[model samples]
Target chain A: MTAAKTNDPPPPPIKYDFLGALLSYLVPGLGQMTQGRFGKGILFFVSLYGLFFYGWLLGSKKNVYLPDYHSGETSIVSRLASDLYTRFQFVGQFPIGMAAWPAIYQYVVSVQGNEKPPLNGFMSSPSLEELNNLQRNGDKTWDLGWVYTVIAGVLNVLVIYDALAGAAFREVRATPGPLTPPNGGPSK
Target chain B: MTIYVHLPVLIVVVSLVYSATRYDSWNKILREALHWGVRMTSFLFMIGLVLYALSTFL
Candidate 1:
């Protein structure tokens, strides 16, 4: 009698966790933690948050900000240029989720100027002269701090992708050996 | 001075997060992170040195 062939089990269905993605967007690494990836989640949390706070500490919490758009500049070109240089950094900072909320809130307050006791304390826009003075006097900490914070946020974008899609690539198990001739000829 | 002081720490944080996303194995992640961090720091140092040399000459 011929033996019956055993069918292989089907692969598990891929489930897209939208809520988890949202959680991660709201708070870095939350999605991974929700998906039981505690180690990865914790790593992202500590690293991203640490970098964010380090930047804040270095810059006195004033590095992340939007330009004062409503400062009554009527020239479109100047306004656009100012926004590009001053506010465009928000693009990088936005991905860090809650870590960036305070900055966003401060930006809104600065733009509206209606809020009593603005959300940002001691956060005044430094004039060009003052900035030059700071740089000349060897106070380049603010520039470096701003860059670090922006980079941290950019890194979170990758972390968020990993959390949502899982690891980008799988670990290769087999050791790669040197190629051999088809007929097992003498090795080169 | 402050910028240079934080450069190594920033490199480590960046490498750790970057490698963690690329690999699932903790051992592989840590190993790759150190490798990447060293590589990146070396690259930056080389660039800085080149720039300084060019500035002096030009």
Candidate 2:
């Protein structure tokens, strides 16, 4: 009679890094690819890139270019200023300026050495100019950037949730220990 | 500028810089950076909404 043969137990589950998934949310697609989900990663990047492009276009049309410098007038160089300046006269200005210049001038200009954003909406002569800009392109037509920002914000939330879910999936499979009975029961 | 505007912009700048840095290893810092980015973006977006409301009414 031959002796009974023994076999090695199955390997434990693979664990995933939660931090990796969070990072993927920041970069969109990096985390998923790192976790070996190439298809998911590609999809993430596509969605992220698509919204980014749309946001950029909407922002550009609104004259809200992301400033290159944050310090001062010289500090705020813009990349699009070179290319789109002619097409959109205000291409390099921050998007907020569309709403800001008018309101600020109305409230703060009357006060001496005023530098603060207005606490309430104020109107002044220069506001007429800004309003004309708003109206020239049709009142409703130029307000689309707000819509873009809202949509992009929503998409980012979805991407973050997806990343978190992927991380949770990783956690479920991490350990490889045998399923020994908790009360020290005999192995099957 | 008002604190609301300044704070949101500062948050965004710090988050963006942190996210774009060169780091050799993955660490808790990266996770925190992402969290900060999400927070800052949310803050700015909220402020944007407030501005929208103010623009439309007051």
Candidate 3:
């Protein structure tokens, strides 16, 4: 009597949803929480809140300018006091201020000069004619703040997901599971 | 930098306490700890979603 030998295919690879994870990562706390990481997720969200408050405080002091095409000017809204600015700046990296990504992108692109012409209240530099033209045609500058905010929001979601998923995957891998024989064969 | 820096330390502290109380052996500890971690992480995930919505609307 001879025993038969059979080869079995390898188990299917564990599917890792990288994009889903990335979405979580863009946010402070998300993905892992979705998978059941409650503590970490809460911590991340709280951290985000702290950063936002800090930025809000800082943004309160100096003008956080958002160009308004309709008005044909840079609408420089007064921000918080200098004290608030200093306090917020100290923790700037965490909450990621309103201008966080915008500042970083601007720096990366090496935009030397200010987009809004340095002048008094919004569109002070532009003549009446130019202002009228911008208003009629549409102002890209005004939209920049909102656009950036949306981008940041989207990125935050991604980050949160990524963080949670990454941790979950790591935890899963680190924890061992029961072993089984290859080829669906029973171990004797 | 403010809260972010403190977070790692906080996570570690919580993990230690959780492992100490919730775990019996290495495997048990690891499993429980991970489960808790994931749970905590998920909570944050929901909060983040809420915040994102808040940011968008308000």
Candidate 4:
């Protein structure tokens, strides 16, 4: 008796979890953890947070900030120039959610001239004299700190992408060929 | 201390995070991370030596 030939079913399509991706954006490894990838999630959380805090400590919280264009300088050209030149590093730092808040708050307070913003370790604005001193001293530490913080922020973006996109390369299953019989018979 | 000391720490962290993202298995991740870390450190050392030589001669 001849064996009946049957076609194999197609593999299921890959499903992307948008909510998980969003959660990853909000908190670096939360999405992976939610998806039961506890080890990966924790690893991401620890590494990213460690780098961020270390950078912050190195920079003394001055590294992350939105550009401060002077008051009433609403010209689009000037804004673009400020962003491109003075605050470009912020483009990298903005990906870090909560850790970046102090800088954002400082920017808002500086622009709005809010009632003397309270002095805190993270948000304490350096006085003009201190700024001048930093400038005159040509402090390489400040530059290094800024670079470290920017790098940390940029690296978190990689973590977020990993959480959302799984491995860059995945192993795909080989499809069954017509020449190969399901019961292991050789092709005629 | 010179800022260059931070380079090794940065490389280690980057290698660990990068390897962790690529593999699900802890052992595989750690092995690959160490491999990458060594490779990066060696490459950086070579570049630093070349730069120092250039600076000294020029």
> Which digits, one per residue and each the tens of the lDDT, describe model 2 over residues A1-188?
99777554444564445765566545666666776766656655655545444443543333322222122233223433432343342221222122224432533343333444343433222234664676585544334543443344344444455555533222223457678887999867
Candidate 2: stretches off by over 4 Å: A1-16, A61-132, A167-188, B1-58
Q: What is the lDDT of residue B17 in candidate 2?
A: 30
- Give the top-scoring candidate (lDDT): 1
Q: Estimate candidate 3's alpha-carbon lDDT, on a 0 to 1 scale.
A: 0.42
TM per model?
0.75, 0.34, 0.29, 0.78
In candidate 1, which residue pairs clash?
none
The candidate 1 chain A region of ten consecutive residues with least summed lDDT is A115-124
Angstrom error at residue B41, model 4: 0.8
Which of the CAPRI classes, incorrect, acceptable, medium or high, describes model 2? incorrect
DockQ of each candidate relative to the true complex: 0.80, 0.03, 0.03, 0.55
DockQ leaderboard ranking: 1, 4, 2, 3
State each candidate's clash count: 0, 7, 54, 0
lDDT of 4 by residue, A43-64 (tens): 8778777776677666656666
Q: Between 2 and 4, whose lDDT is larger?
A: 4
- Candidate 3, A1-188: lDDT as tens digits: 99776554444555576654654544555554665655655654564544343333333212223222232223322222332243332222423333344433432232234554432332122344754664466534323322333333443543443453333233322444456777877756
Model-by-model lDDT, in order? 0.77, 0.45, 0.42, 0.72
Which DockQ-derived CAPRI band holds candidate 1? Answer: high
Give the higher-DockQ candidate: 1 or 3.
1
Which residue pairs clash within candidate 2? A12-A176, A13-A173, A14-A173, A14-A174, A15-A174, A64-A95, A69-A75
